[model samples]
Structure formats: C-alpha cells, structure tokens
Target: MGVQGLASFLDKHQNIYREVRFGRSRLLVDGCNLNYLLYFSSGLDQNHGGEYAAYVTLVESFIAALRSCDITPYVVLDGGSDVTDKKLETAAKRREDRIRKAHEAAASGRTMCILPRMAELVFIQTLARLQVPVAQCFAEADQEIAALASEWRCPVLSNDSDFFVFDLPGGFLPISHFHWREVRQSGSRSSVSCRRYYTSSFCSFFGLRRQLLPAFAALAGNDYVKLRGIDWTRFVQAGTGTEACGRLEGLLCWLKGLQESRGPLEVLEEALGLLGDLSGDKRELLQNLRLGMEEYQLGRSALSRFFLHGAPPEFPALEQEAGLVPGWMLLPVTQARLSGNVLDVLRLLRMNLGFGIETQELPSANQTSRPLRQVMYGLLLGKDRSSPVVEFDRAGLGPISVPVEPTFTRTSQRLRLDSLPQVALSDRLNVLLEALGVTQESLRLLPPQLQLPAAVSCYWLQTAQPPPDLQRALLLGMSNTPRSTAAFQNKSGIQKVDVDVSHAFSQWQACLKDAAQLNQLLGLPLPEPDVSRLYQGTLVHQLVHRMRSGGKLKTVLRSDRPSEELYRSLLSVVRRIRTRRTRQTRQKAATRRQQNPPEPSADLQRLFLQDEETESEARAAVAMQEELRLQEELLQVRTRYRTKERSNRSKNPDLARKEECRGRDLL
Candidate 1:
C-alpha cells in the first residue's frame, strides 16, 4: 500500500488494539533512515512541486495525529560526519553505485530523473518542516539514538531492530507492520491472546531470554547480505555453531575459574589460558574482549586505590568478564550509560546479596548480575591478587570531646587601675591621651604628665554620674572668700558673689572652648550638649597634672615626696598671701597695745601685787601644760615607729622600706 493508504487503514483500525498509556511517554525516531527513505522514494515526486506539498501535508497530518494522542516525539538525524575513513569510502562507493543506476535508468527512459529527485526533495522538505523536537548526531547515528532512547526510556520507531541490540531494560518498543498485525490479531481474539502471540513470537524468533539479539546478529551476520547475493553461511556457521558455542563455554569456564582464583594474577592466567584456546576471527574477537576487560579491571583497581589513599596506580589491569568494557573506564557518555546499567545491576545484586558480606572470590548469582563488579573481581582474582577489604571507621564521624579542669578554667586578665602607682598611672594616662590626639590647649592647664587615677576619676565624673562626696569636695575647694566677693560687689561690679560667679562662668566657658579644640584634636565627634567634650578636656588636664606631679591629690590620699613638691609649690603661693595678712594683723595689734599701754593708780599698784602672784601661778600651769604636750608628741612618734615595723614584717619588707623612706622624705 501507498503511505496514504497505510495511514488511512491504521486510522480506521486504531481502536482495534487495546491502548496502553505510558507514564511520561516519549517517542524517539531515527531521522536519518526516515529521511533517506523519503528522499529515494518515487512516491514523493516533488519535481512538479505538488509532491513536495503532499509530503509536507503528510508529515503535518502525522504530527497532528501524534498531538491528538498526547505523544511527544523526538527525532534524531545523522550528519554522516562521524563515519570512519574506511566507512566513508564504502558509503561513497555505494552512493556512486546508486547514482549510476539512476543515470542508466534515466538514459533508458524507463524511470524519470524528475521522479527520484522529486522524491528526495519531498522527504527532505517533509523532515525539515516537522514540528516535533529533533536532534542530530555528528556520526554514529545509531549509537547516539540508542543512547538517548535508553537514557530517556522512550519508545523507538525504526525499521532496524538494532535498538534492541543495546539491551535497554524497559520503555522501548519497535514500531512496524508487525505491530499492526499484532494489533489486528489481538482485536479478533482476546487482548491477552494477541499480547501472548507477539511476546512468544518475539522470544522464540529472537531468543529473548537474555535479550541476546546482538550476540545472535554478531554470529549470523547481516540478513541483507544474503539478499544482496553474498554467501555469509560460513561466517554465520563459524560464529553461531560448534566453534562459537565452544568459545562462549570456554569464556564462561574461564570466568568460573577466575572466580575461584586467589587473586587477579590467577584470573589473568585463566584469561590467557582461554585466549590460547581460540583461533582465527573468533580468537581475535576474544583477544579484544580480553584486552577491554583487562583495561577495565585496571581502572577499577586504580579507583579503589584512589578512594582508599587519594592516589591510584599508574597502570592497573582491566577486567573483561562482561564482554563489554568497564563503565568507569569509558568516555563520558558511554561511561554514563554503562555506569547507570552497572548501578542498576549492583542494586539488584545488593538486594539479593545483602551489605557488608565478602564475596570477593566467588562469582555468585549476585556477581553475575552485577557485570561491572564481576569483571573487576574477575580481573583481580585472575591477576592473582585479593582486593583490599575497605572498612569505614564510623566512629570518626562523631563530635570530639575535650576534658577541662575546674581550676584551669579560662579567665580574662585585665590591669587594675587601683593597683597602679600614681606616677605610673599618670604616665599611662598621658600616653593614652596622646594616642587619642588630645590638644595642647586642653593640656596647658595640666601638669606635664597624665595619670590613670586622675584620668579615671575625671572620666567617671564625665561619663558616669559624679559621686556626691566628690562633687561636694570639689565645690568646697572652689569656694570664694566673702570679703573678696563683697569688695568686688561694691567696686564697679554687681553682687560680690555674682562677680565671682561671672568670673567662674567665664572660666567654664573658656574650658568649653578648650574642650571643643581638644575634641577636634582627638578626632571625637562633637557632643550635642557638649558635656562629653567638657569632661574629656577637664580629664586630660587633671590626668596630666596628676601624672606630672607623681601623685594625685584627689584620688591618692597618701602624698609621696614628688607629690609633696607639688603641694609645697601650691602652699608657697598661698603662704605669700597668708604672710601679708599676718603682717597686717601684727601691725594692728601693736597699735592697740601701744594705745592701751597703762592707766596705773595707787590702788592699782596694791592690786597689782596680788595680781602678780596670780600671774605667777598661771605661768607655772602654762609651763606644765607645754611639758605634757611635748611628752604626748614623743609617745606618738614611738608608737608610730613600732606599728610601722610590725607592718613591714607582715608585708613585702622591701616595699615597706621604700614606703617608709618616702613617708620620711615627705615629712
């Protein structure tokens, strides 16, 4: 029947067959074969253009039908670029032969040139216009198509039965007239009956038990060779008959022997023995298989070694027990496909064999199923070496615990400001202020060095709330005399206290200005209330003064010799004012004594005698009081010396001696 007739017939009888729906079904087609048929067929006479239109229409119709059935089809094409040089030459010869035949036919006027060319154009145009998803392989179209189909687990549409040659596990069905026949037969009988007929027929004709179609084809050669008038019976006989069967038997026997061997060397010895028994083409095939297996086994050994110690052998042997090369040893795509198969086989084997059981030397049913592992084991055993048993240290996967002692617990060590000497603290504060870039203006009012005790005290007053005692002490020290204040109030000023307040306020304002300058120098951000600025400036001055003087008056109660010098300098300034006041008082007293010197009378003289006696007694009492004061002073000195000696014995004697010297110097 023509294509249209066939299509119409299939459409009419579509419901006759029981429909089977595939979950996530996809159809993979051989584009090259389809295109070739279309291009060569005279049925697609596209020279008149009408044939090309018809071809396009036919493809569209087919696509529409597929869409209606919700079947997605992926078409694959071959570019003929991947063909080997030898194959290319052969293809060229075949093409030439076809062209010559066409030319001869045209010359005879038996068949028109328009017919073949039109047919070719129609097929090409039809395929090009196909709306379905398509992929094209550079070379080895069959291999690419088979691989993709296997990967996607899609049904295949092809005239060649080679798709089954790969032995893909599931979801691949060959489409043909045979399928239509099966469908029709199923409708006439029961659905089950039709399925059984096709299934049994396929098994019996193809020997489907192991899906050994490839092996059969390898033995029988091509059926078309006979059609082309080539006598391939001898080749077929040599491949499938006594010799081929014997070779397979010998191979299986060798596999069994390798399984029994102690190591890979022994397996290799058995393989060589099997190799020695084969001859001619069969011998060559067996040798190739052996080499592929040896390479694969070597790859496995290397991988094992790598997993164990992060480095593999330079050249390990390949195992060839499965006839195919090891999946792990192949190039990416081939390796991916083979690895998938290997994993599946391994899973199935594992399901039956269980985990953690050693079956290295034995080729059980589990090993037979897992072709990859079987090959590896065989290579190792044949080569006379036992595969290392890798046992994972599961305990290494847990958290590590460290024992710690209570007495050795971690603690942060920080310097205690209270423990620092006033001079040392002052030096540290000066360093800290300098590091912070405190300005000279802020430091001008201070002594040369800054101390931590004064700095810390000033810092607390600035950042923290000032203590009541400290605030009271500061106010008391800053108090002005009432006379000076009153005199200023009467002399071109407001109230005397107001005058003092105004002067103090101006000083405070100057201090704030100094603070601002210091903030700029120290890279501190300006405060909104400017309290921080004021505090920092004051702190710098105080800390520096304390540091320079060697002892702070406010924080450190005890005064050392260096501190006494600072106190003495302040006292010297105050003493000048005190001395001037004392001199004025003496002058006033002298004038009073002179003015009130005498108003003497006779009765006063008589009274003076008795008064003189009372005066004498008063003088004696005053003398006795002075002696008692001296004795008390000596007793205090002696008591202080004894207490100090005891304290020195209890503490660091050297530190005590130094402190005593410092106290004596200050005194």
Candidate 2:
C-alpha cells in the first residue's frame, strides 16, 4: 500500500522514526481509518445497542485521549471510494469478500468487521451528538488531511502509508504509535527516554534529496504502480550505503549490466516511459519509476482546502453541503461534569448515550420509551445566549441601541478536557478485567460459553489474533463436533459455517509440550509436574535462614533434603489456599448484606468478623450508611411540602411560592 518495502526497509537500514511530543497541537484525523479501528475493536452483536455504543465510545475516547494529551483533534471522513482505476478494482474485490463475510456473520448472529453502508452517516451523527469538529471530504480523506496538515502546520494522524506521497512540510504522525517509547544508550552508556515520521527527516535519513523522493518511490512501486518484468532480486543491495551522488548512477550501472547490449542511458529512458502504463511487479527500475510519476501526479492534496474550507459554491449551483464548520463543542457528557478518567469518562458517555440515563430519567417502568435522539438533540442545543451588543458606533450611528435579543449558542470551542488522564487503547480492556475481578492466570480456565463473548467484547486495536478466548476454550477440551448445524431462514435459508479448531488444539498441545521440556530435562523422580523440587520453597527458605544466621537458609538444608523442602512448600500452598477461601467467604458475606441486610448467625458472622480491625471497620460502615437513609427520608418530606406549595400557588396566584417557582404549576 505504501512504497512497497518502505516500512521494512527503514527498519532494517536505519532508525527513521523518532518520538516527539506535540502537546497543545491539533491532529488531523483520518476518519475512515478510525471507523475500521472501531469496527474491529467491537465484539457485540450488531443487533445490540451496545455494539453501536462501543463504536461511539471509541470515537469519543479517541478524541478525549488526544485532548488529554493536549492535542486537539479534527475528524475528516471520506466522501467515496473513487480512486485510480487499478486501485478501485482492488478495492471492489476486497469489498466483495467483506460482503460475503458480513452475510455469514448475520446468519451466526455475531459482530463482524465489515463497515456498514450507514457507517459514514452514523459517524457524522455521532460526532454531531458529541459536538466535536468533523468534516466530510468531497473525495478521499487522505488528501484533505494531508493538505490541511500542511497548510495548518499540524501533523496528519493516520496509519495509511500513502500520506508520504503528499510531500507535506508539517509531517505525519502515525496514529498506530501515538505514545511510542524508544531505547537508546546514553553517553554514560545508559538508555534514556526521549517523534513523527517527517517526510523531510525520512528523505534525510535515506541520503536522498526531497526532490528525488518521487524517483525513489517510482523505483519501489506502490498501490497504483507495480513492479514489472524482472524479479528485482539483488536490486538496491542491502548495506550499500554509498553517497547520494553515487546511488542513482550505481542503480543505472546495475540495470545496464543486466542487459549486455543495451547502453545505460537507453535502459533508463525506456523503463521511465512505460512504468505506470501497466500493472505488476518487475525487475526494471525505470518501469517502477514511470508508474511512480503517474501516481505522484495523481496526488490529490492540492485540492484539499477546496473540500475542507473553500468559499461556499453559489447557492443555485450547490447540490450538497460539503464541509463542516470547523471548531470543538462541549458534548452532553461534559454536562455530567466528569473529571475524564477512563471509568468516569466512560460512565458519563454511556449516561448521555441513553444506556444509563433512561432508568433514571423516567419516574416509572410503565412509561413509554423516550427517543434518545430527542433528548440528545436537546442536550446538543446548549444554553441560550444574549445577542451581541448593537455597536452602532461601528456604522457611525452614534450610540444607537436596539431592543434586547436572545439567541442560543449551538457549538462550544474548547481545546481541552479536564485535567484527569485518559486510558490508552492497550490498557482500556484491562479496566474491564479489573471490574470483573479476574487476573491473567484465570484466563485459561474461563468457561466455554462465556469465552468468545468475553473475548469479542474486549477486542480493541491491540487485541492479539487467534484471540486468547479461542485458546482458553481449546484448553477446556472439545465436545463431539456437530456433524450438521440446523438450517435457518430469513428471506432464504442460510448454511451454518462450521469451524475446525482441532488444528488449533494440536498447535496448543505442541506449545504445552515445549513448556514441559524443562521438567523432562531435570530427570526428576516425579513425572510431569509431580517432582517435589518443582514446587519446593527451599530457595526462599534458605535465603531467610541465611539472613537469620547472619551469613543463610540453603546451607542448613542439605542438598539431599528433598522431603523437608517438599513438606515446607506443600504447607505453604495449603496456607495460601485457606487464605483465598477465607477472603472469598468474607466477600460473599458482604455481597449478601448489600442485597438484603440481615443479622448473621454466630458462625456466619465470625467468618467476616475475623479480627478487631475488621469488626471496627464493619461497625463504621454500618453507622455511616444510616446517614444516607436519614437524608433520603428528609428529602421525601421536602418534596411533599414543595408540591403542596406549588398546588396552592396555582389555585390562588397569591401563594408565597408563586413568584419563586421555576416551572409553572398549571397541572
């Protein structure tokens, strides 16, 4: 997709990328890239609102995270997939494959990574609801982002390799590496922590001038132009760190050598002429170079401003609205007044998104469903504003003032969220695991039915493939494979797609064997994991003994003392198990008390009343909880009196409360 071998080439030959901080700067986001990011990250069935909510949350958090890092975000979405004919054909083929997968997923009733037809609209609507700045490009988002970044002097945030073709001065920061770390030895021989992949920096590192970038790309070939004719094996030989002046001529010499009769000059000219006219990888450098020029010429960045911020076309000729007015606006989540930590921000977002608010907003369950869009629209409208001052002096009217006018502000332009930090994509799923009170060790033992759902629900940008759930499920062992699945009908019957995980199981078993090789190498008396030394706590015991002896523990214990060591280790294990059970018993008692407060029997109560400290804490908790109960009763009385006062006010228009009532008491 990028210069064919650019990524690998840079990694092997030199350190091309450097980590740089861009605090308080604006990032131009590629919305199409983020849409796929969210789709793949979600695990809920498409039928569930939670799936949609996850998509919305990802976009919200992505912006929030950047803002938290002091970088403002401007989202730009693609208008259509129109592209060069060759690229369009490739995109069409991929789209067909995606369509087939979507059909299969629909039958199975699970989430798939296909971007829905409504995705672009849904994205725009979500951003509208969130009050974030967003733009829909007339063509590709890449062109818009590249052009905007260059003109605005900001970094384009994306993983798409083609941005390099824009030759922008402001540079590009790969979204995949927003918070990358680096390791390097210092002059004191210690690594100290310190960027973007600037086009200028990249060319500098490659020992090529900026102007030669097109030439370099042509030789490499790309999505639009492909290498053709020869294998290109041994081309641009590795470690050939020759000077810049020698590089091009060296390439010419290599090409001329390939053809005994042809002169170097003719070889170069012929290859350059026919490069982009065809498709396919070949050994000829000039063929690749020719295609590169064609691709470069097609770069669309020059027209970016027209799509992002050009003057509106004459209304009579305007067929559609093309751009969003640029600026940030506070979302309803901000009204929740959250401090923006991961959990708090997530809670606020869900509340505003209609997941949490509905239960609380309506007084009773018998009430009809409230359309979320209506509430969202009201929240998005924001507070009313007084009209701007008349300022007749500017028109030379001499102190003229107009009647008062009231207007409502629709959008807010804020650069930052609260001081609280946002969670990274890598750590976001860990929050869910923490809430569930599960650790990495329990992953392999999770039940089968819950495995896939849990795995999918937690899938994020950094989720590993062949998801751990599949591995965990395979570990629990398999059942008799279903020979045929029941057929189902929607408009037509759909066949079930059966998965064969036997190979995966075999692969896991092989992995287990490799791990067990340690035990086998030791030649212990115990088979597999049964050896006494395997779990022996002698190492720690010896260290403790040594400390007490003012020397060590290992010395007092003879090397042959396996029985004593085994006994100590087994005893330690027993203690750990008992402690785990005791903690679980206390947790259960606490949960029961929360569900239904009851005095426990002597034996049951003693389980949690383990020590003086615990008993004191329990007493404190009981005493403090009653304070809220009393406050609630007081609130009920206040509400009763207030309603009575309102009723009196409505009846006579003479009640003391009439002047102060915020809402009319007509009812």
Candidate 3:
C-alpha cells in the first residue's frame, strides 16, 4: 500500500546506499507503527489487566533506546481519518474489521476494547507525561510526516515506504531492521556504531534526484494514486540489449524534463510521446495516471497543517504574567464542600500539571443543592473554540475554565464528540475520586482488592442495587456492558437486564492470566502485577513497586533475572556517557594547554609554588653563611686593636686600673 514495488527496488540495489550514522541526529517517529510492533511482540493477552501499563512500558523502552543513542525524537500519531480523503473506503474496511473483532471479543467475554485508538491514547499520554513534543495528524500520517520532516529538517523514522514517494530532502529511515552501523575513519583510527540510514543515496543509485522521486513514485501506485503498468521493472526491460538500464535512466531524465515547467497539459504531451509506443492502451493508461496525480495534489493540500505552524487569532499583549502556585491548596471541608454537601470529594482529586486550571470564574448558583456539579456543567458549556488562546505549562483554574486543551487538538480542528482533555491517562494518571461522595479515608477502609472494584459496584448499586459481582466483573474489564444499556448509567433512566455472571469465576481467572501475561510480556518479575501502575507508575517499576502496601519487596524474592535487551540498552547508555566524559576531559586539557603551554611536573611544581620545607632549606643556608661572614670581620678587627691596647696598658697601670673600674661599672 506504500509506494508499490519500492521495497523490491531498494532490496535489489541495497549495497550502493551507504552513509555514516550520527548519534545526535534528529528523528521523527511514527508512534502507531512502533506500537503495533510492540503489541505483536507481546503475545495476545487473555485478559486485559493493566493494558495501559503494558503499552506505556513498551513505548518507554523504545524511546530510551532512541535517547540513549543521543537522537532527538519527535513523535507523531495518526488522528481520526479525514472525511474527504480519497482512501476512505480503505479506512472504512479497517474500521469494519475492528468492529468485527469487537463483536468477537464480546462473544468471548473479553471486556477490554482492543482497538488501536486505545494504544494511540496511551502513546499520547506517555509522551505528555515525559514532557516530550508530540503531534497527532488530522488525517493520514504519511503526508504529515513528509511535511513536518521538511519543516523540521530531520530524518523520518517509519516502517512505511511512502516517504520515498513523499520526496523529503532529508529522506526517511526505516527502523524495521534497525541495528548499529559501524563507521571506520579514513585512516586506521577505529570504528564506532550508530543508528542511521540515508534514503537519498538509494535514489541517486537509481539515477533519480529529489525532485524526480514523486514522478517515480507515481509510476508505482501509492496510497492516493492508482496508476497501472508503470512499474520500474517494466521500464528496466523496455530498452534494447545490455543498455536497458541506461535507457531507464533516459526515461527518468525525460520525466524530469516534463516536470520542470509544472504544467499538467504540457507535461501530458511529453508523457504521451514517451509512453505512447509502450502499450496499445497508452491513452487510457496516461489518463488514469493524470487523475491519480490530481488526487495526490489534493491530498497534499488537505495535509498542509503539518507544515503550517498554527497561527491562532492574535491575543491581547499582557503587561504581566501570573506565577504558578507550586504548593498544594489544602481545601478543608469549607471550600471543597458544595452548597449542602458536608463530604469533601475535591480534596481527594490531585490537580496535576504542577499547575492549577487558569480561566475566569463561572457564575455560582446561589440556591442550587449541588453547586459544584452545576459549576462543572457550566464550564463545559462555556468553552470557546475560536478564542485567542495561549499555551501555558501550568494555569490555575481559580475561575471558570474548560479543560485546558482538547484531546484531539494536536491534529484535529474538529471532532465528532467533544473530547475531554483533563482526565486520567496511561503512565501519568490523575487519580480522581469522581462521583464517589465519601470521606477519602472511609473509601480506603475497604479491603485492598475491593477498593477499586468498589467504586464500580457503588455506581450500579445506587442506580438499581445490581449485585456487586456484576459491577466487579465490569470493573475488572472482563465483560462488556450489554448493548442494551449505556456503558454506565447516565441522566436518563437507562436500565439493563442483570449482567450474566455465568463466567464470573472465569473472568477473575482471566484477570490473573492477563496479569501473568504482562509479566511475561515485560519478561521480568518486579512485583505481583498492580493494575493502577498502568496509569500512575510514571514508567518506573521500582517506584510503582514501592507504592505497594508491602513497602519495597525484595526484587530477588519476586524474580532474580535480567533481560538481555535491557542490559544491552543500559550498556549502550553507559558507553555513550563514557564517551561524552572522555570528550569533555580531552577538550578541557586542550584548553588548559592552550592557556599555559606546559604543565609542571611534581618537583617543578613544588619549586614554582615555593614549598615551605624547600624554602626553609634555602633560608637556613643563607643564615649560616651570613653568621660566618660576621664572625670573620669581628676576628680581623680584634687582631688590629690587640698590639695598640698592650702598649697603652704598660704606659699607665693606674689608668688601666681606672679603665678596669669603668669596665666593671659598664658590666
């Protein structure tokens, strides 16, 4: 369904397409494509316990691999199909297949909806939790991928081969056979492995350029096109003798010439001359191709949003901005309680996003019994679609606020059903006690297994006192709500026959089986499966395990094992970190040498800084030499005075006695 025969062409000439891979390249990912691979890898689950958790785990692992290799990933998922698309019939066929599967699952007592949308939701939520940029395309993902790749100037990573036809300048990378590509230096330095591929190399080998790819793609039918009898192999066989490949290259050049002027009628004349003699039905064939080209053009127009950065109506420039209240708002029974209600249900709800809702206050009802419920309905009704809007990380909803953004807003400007944005989702859950009007502690008083199941049991019980077992079955996701009734009771007095409990025991058994399968799928044992982790784990099993009642159960006691893939990923990350550290150290040393020219050795360094012991040795030698010089001078002076003093002493003994007396006085 991708470019027809493109895979075979690439396989036939694989060796000529060679390029070096970079660790830090930007990659655009096809989220749905990767999720299907993971889903298949995880054998079919018999039960649906923690389905969201399983999806979150697989996606996180794949993302980790991309990140460990230093790739900046931009994830994109397919949104609801375009109503005006040329391929609605194909999309409908797929939906019918899902409907059939849903029926079959219902018949088999499987409560979980195994549709692809659930997986898509899980993907979007996981990326949101990680604060990663993700976009959901309004229609087919192929054109959007091409458009965004062009805008972002990064390689597209997808299993689909439609990218070759899309004619991206950067080309696409298929990760279906993803592995390390070893690149050796021109000299005998060394080789290193990285994940990379270049599709342009393949185009060049086939004697095609970026501009000519879409023409070549048209030759082989694509999703939006249905041209016939223009296969590459057919062109290869059209030439005479051993020069057929050269003739094929000539054909490409002719096609490129036709496209230079960009006029359909003018190109049609040249196409007729080139293709006229190829077949007896040339006119009909060319006409069919012309129609296909028109459709492709129309498809591109429909998907321009991907290339167009959203420019909403201009908002008023603000003089100042509001700051986030990072601390929790402790809503005691006073503020959280409704007009007449005494129990505080709002306190149990965590206003996540590390920010509060930011909107104006809804007019409060003075006399209403359920003022909070009235406020919620008013907020939902007051949402404006075309209002000037600004995206904020955290906005307090101290006033009237609709959900900050709609779920499908990434790709879609419209929806069949208004999607509620602020709700619980996979891996990052807003665990709210919705409609459970009771003390948080009182709700916790139930047995551990009974707590979550009790919420569902209470819903059906209050409506019609249906047995707790049916609610338990419904809550476990082991049985579907009968087609006769709504998913759960609503404003209308919706009623249902008692849920068939013939398979209640079997359903419980299936829950255990699904939990076991998740472990097998995860291929490790960390703790007995906790369903809530599917939502609240934040993708860390260790953290989720600690949240368990038993407090950090020994992993060894559960299962002492490691996965090879896990270790390999860890090892790759370790190598990357080591390489980074080495590069930094080398750069630092180079800078140091540039500044100082030479690094001093230990002894030289000591001399340069004047160590105390070395300084003391030099000081001691100088002191002793000075002392010797002074002693020598004193001895010489005494020798000169000695004879004169002796002569004087003989001349005057009495004077000597007086001098002796003066010396005694001086002493």
Candidate 4:
C-alpha cells in the first residue's frame, strides 16, 4: 500500500494526471505477455504453492499504484501456454513463415515487414483493448512503443533493452525493480548507461539495423543462437545451413502464426479506428503503418493494383500552348473540360478579344514575331436562335495580318470594321464589357457603322412623349359608337410617345382614319407624313380613343367647350351605328327563329282554337246593332252551309256525284 511515490507524481504533473483521468494518456503496454501473466497468476491455487498468489497480489498493487499516479497502464499477454503447447508450436511455424516473407520483402528492396512483430502486436492489442486515450502502434511492439514515446515526448515502459535502439525522447523506465537491480549489479549505473551497453552489445552481436534487419538476419545469423554464442557463420555464408535456415524459417513461421491469431484482430480494428480518427502527422503515421501492414499481408502484387492509369500528357501541353502560366492555365483547361463545345467557343472568343489575355511566355519563343490574335469567333456566330450581336468598339489593337498557316499566304487588312460577321451574341457581352471597363461613349467613337458582321442588331428606338395630361379625348356613347367619327385624330394634344417609335408606327392603322379626319378639319395641307408624325398621330388617336371608351364621358367632356361639341358629335355617330347594329342583330335572330319554329303541343293548339272563337264573338257584339245583326245573320248562314258541307263530304256525296256523271255519259 506504499503510495507516496504515486501521489507525488500525480501532484507534480497535475495537467498530465488530468489528461490521464480523462483517458487522454498516450501510454503503451505489452498485451500478450500481460495477459499470459494474469492468467498464469490467476491459476495459482493453494495446491500449486502460494507463490503465484503473491505475484498476482504484487501485480495488482502495482496497477493500483499506477492508477493513483494517474499513469494509465495497458497490459499485454503472449498467446502461448503450457496446455496449448501444440498450438504454440504450430503458431511458431507460421511465425517463421512470415519472417521468411519479411526477408523476401527486404531482399526486394521494400521497407515493409512481413508481419506485425510479436512484441508490437502485444503492445497494440493491449492499448486497443484498454481503450488507452493515446496514439499506439503494434507489430514490433517494443520498437513501435519506443518510436511512439519519442514521438509524444513520453517515457517508454518495458524491460526489453532493444527499445534503446529507438532513442526514446523521455528515456526508458524498466517495469521491475529487480531488473533494475540486476542491471545495476551488472555495473550499469544509470538507465542511459544500461541502454547504451544493451545497444552496443546487440549491434555487435547481431548486426542489427544493417541496411535491412530481416535480410541481414536471413543472410548472416539468428539472434537467439548468436546471443547464445553458437557459431553459425559458415552456415549463414553457405546459405544452405540447417541451423541458420531453421531459425529464419522458425521466425517467419512464428510471424505467420501471430497473424493468424485471433487476439490481434480486434486490436488491429481498434488501431484502424484510431487511424481513421487521427489527423495531421499522427494520422499520416498511422496511415503509413496501415499501408505497411496491408503490404505485408497481401504482398506487392496486391499493392500494385491500387494505382490508377497515369493522366494524359496532352492536357498540360495544350494549356501551355494557350500561352498561359501554370496555375492560370489550369482554370481555362478545367473550364474547357467541363463546358459544352458552345461555351468553349465563347471562352475562346473572349480570350481572342483580349478579354483575359495577359502577356506571358508562349509555348514557343520562335513564334513571337507574329502578333497573338485572340478574338472570340463565337461572338460572331449565334449561340442559338435567340442570340444577338452586341456592338462595341474594338480596343488596343492595330490592323495586322495573322498568318493562317505555313501554306496559306497572310491576308493583310485593317482588321476591317466590316470584316466582323453579324450573328446573335448573348447579353453576356455586357458582362464581358463591364469586366473590360469599356464605356459606351468610347464604343460610339468607333468607325461609322463599325457594324458587327455576322451580328444581328436588336436595337430599340425610344421616343420622348408628353404625359397623359396632354392626351386628347374623343367621345363614345352607350350605343358603342364614336360621335365625331373623324377619319384622323389631332396630334396637337399629344405630349409624347413613351414607348419606341417603331412600335407605335407599326400600330398606325388603328389611328390612320382619325389622322385623315384631323387633317381635313385643320386644313393642314399635308403629304404622306413621316414616321415621327405617324407615331405622334397614332399616340394622340390612342389617347382620345381610350378616353371616349373608358366609361367617364361626362367627366371627360366637362373641361372644354370644343371638346364637348366634338364629344357630342362622336357620341351621336357612335349611338347611330350601335342602334343600327343592334336592330340588324335582332332582326337576324327573329328570322332564324321563324324559319326553324318549334311545333306547338296538341293541348296548346286546342286552347288556341277555343280562345279564337270567344274573341271573334266578343268583337261581333261590340260593333253597331245593324252591322252586328248583319254579321250575325251572315255568320248563321255560313255556319249552316259549313255544317251541310261537312255532312255531305262525310257521307260520300262526291263519289255519288261521280257515279251519276258516269251513268249520264253511258246514256
């Protein structure tokens, strides 16, 4: 329970201790060996002696001390055990196979190892399982741990002297006091001294880190046998000796077996997750490690498959030909790559127009004698049906003939204003102009009609017209007719034509009759008016027509005496025309109905006959007595005759008469 040292360390490094508490310590541990020890110690029952129990207690105490000091600890355990001896043997064989693979990799001049080394795997697995809040490495655990300690400026925790080769930034601290005592007793005073001795001894004995460790090991010797002072030099030189080959084979087999072991898989996944979560330098290292592992496991052939085909050479070359600097050239290339052919053509036009052209090195110096002609040909051609040519003055260039080619003779011309073709250019020209900072007045100064050839002009002509207050009024009546019926309207009241003159003139017919009438009334001897007068007259007529038809005639006629008279005349004419139109419409409707009359039902016809008789009697009685008496007598005689006729007709009198006639003819 001695905890003074632990408490002191925590107090001294409060920030470091806080980080550890929050799981931020980048501590490395030996997983496989720790697990083995834990299991071994746990198995110690009273029967197998109390020694294991004591060991476990001591280990637990040490862990508690570490926790109290805020030193997060990770533990590693070996896979081999007494009960799994056969498995261990098989695993060892696999390890040797991996070592041989590593040797082969080294021979092939690759920096990769064949398998995650035993110690490295232990450290990685322990750190991963414990979820130690720090960067960790596995496979050649001691080496990686030392490397990590150097990277983090932290201490390395291990009894292995091999870690000294890494030159850890915070130095080394052995886990066991007994080991420290043993080293001290062996005349190594300080940890640095001990480390130096270990480094020199190992390098001398095993020739470690000589170009490539695995290859050298494969060629010269084995550590286990060499450390034991066994002479295997001749066997190594021959490259066919059993001992040297056996050791190398064993080492490779052991690595392969470790790779197959299930313990490393979870740790590898955790490492991969950490790698994914990392950024900057840490992430890069982890990535390199991951790649190395992949290379080790899958071999170089698999690694080769990950590379893509090299980019085409002509792309950069084309950019260079465009007289663009490296970075600037790429933008156009990118634009060209993504845009449709039409856009590309536009871009080329802009480039030619000296829009984005800056003086730079052309692809060839010999070609500099000729002026660079950059003109947007697309601007001369319509992008689509709706495109229009934008007119602007060309700037910064004198007439020069551009060489067509080595075969065709150069055509010398003033880059004639007439040379440009007329075509539909998009409004995008304005944007380009703005970018160029060119003013409209400057554009106007260009040669007369410096008309863009192949460019269709879409010009709009605006006319200045007086306001609505100056508009004249015509009169319209409820009968839908204009009162004055003037063949022409007066232009004197018209202030202006707000819209384009061309548009107003196009609708000139609507006001033409009004114009003729106005001319007749005014007695203004006029020939066929010009477009301006026509537009002006048209505007006046429209205003008058609108006022007359706008349903405010009383108010419109109230202002002026002359207007009232005119209004009345127009209204009278409008009403007469409307009345005639209405009558004609009604007559047509009535005639249509009579020609295609609907038949009356039987009941209606009977009612009509009864009513007709009653009416006829009433009318007879209302006449004078004598006239009435005469009418009544005549009616009575008519009725009697009508009855007799009906009877005769019904009894076949006609047939009888025909028979009598025939008999007379026979006689």
Backbone clashes, each candidate: 43, 18, 8, 72
Per-residue accuracy of model 3 over 1-667 as CA lDDT, tens digit each: 3765565546545564444444567777776676665655555342222245556766676666666666777766664333334564554455344444433443454433343223444555466455455655433456666666776677777777775555565666666545423333444333224333455665565545554555555555666556443333434434334333533344454554454545554554455564437665766666655655543231232223422442111211123311111011111101111110101111111111111001112111111112222222222222342222111121122222223221222112221112322221210111112322222333232223233333323322333211223332232221111221122212123111111222222222223322222222111111222332322111122222233325432322222222222222222222233333345665798697788776457547756667785675576557545544544443443343355566888897876675444312211
lDDT of 4 by residue, 532-616 (tens): 1111223244444455456344543444444344333323322333333345665797697688774678447757788886775
lDDT of all predictions: 0.32, 0.38, 0.39, 0.29
Residue pairs with backbone atoms closer than 3 Å in model 3 (clashes): 356-395, 356-396, 357-396, 357-397, 358-396, 360-399, 360-400, 361-400
Model 4 alpha-carbon miss at residue 526, Å: 99
- Candidate 2 minimal-lDDT segment of 10 residues: 480-489
Q: Which stretches of candidate 1 lie over 4 Å from their true place?
A: 1-24, 38-42, 46-50, 86-93, 109-130, 169-175, 178-211, 222-667
**TM-score for candidate 1, residues paired by index:** 0.29
Per-residue lDDT tens digits for candidate 2, residues 296-333, read 44333443443356322121112232211111111111
**TM-score preference between candidates 3 and 4, better one:** 3
Tens digits of per-residue lDDT for model 1, 463-499: 2211112322222122212232223224321111111
Q: Which candidate leads in TM-score?
A: 3
Q: In model 1, what lDDT does residue 22 have?
A: 30
Which of the two, 2 or 4, has more TM-score? 2
Global fold similarity of model 2 (TM-score)? 0.39
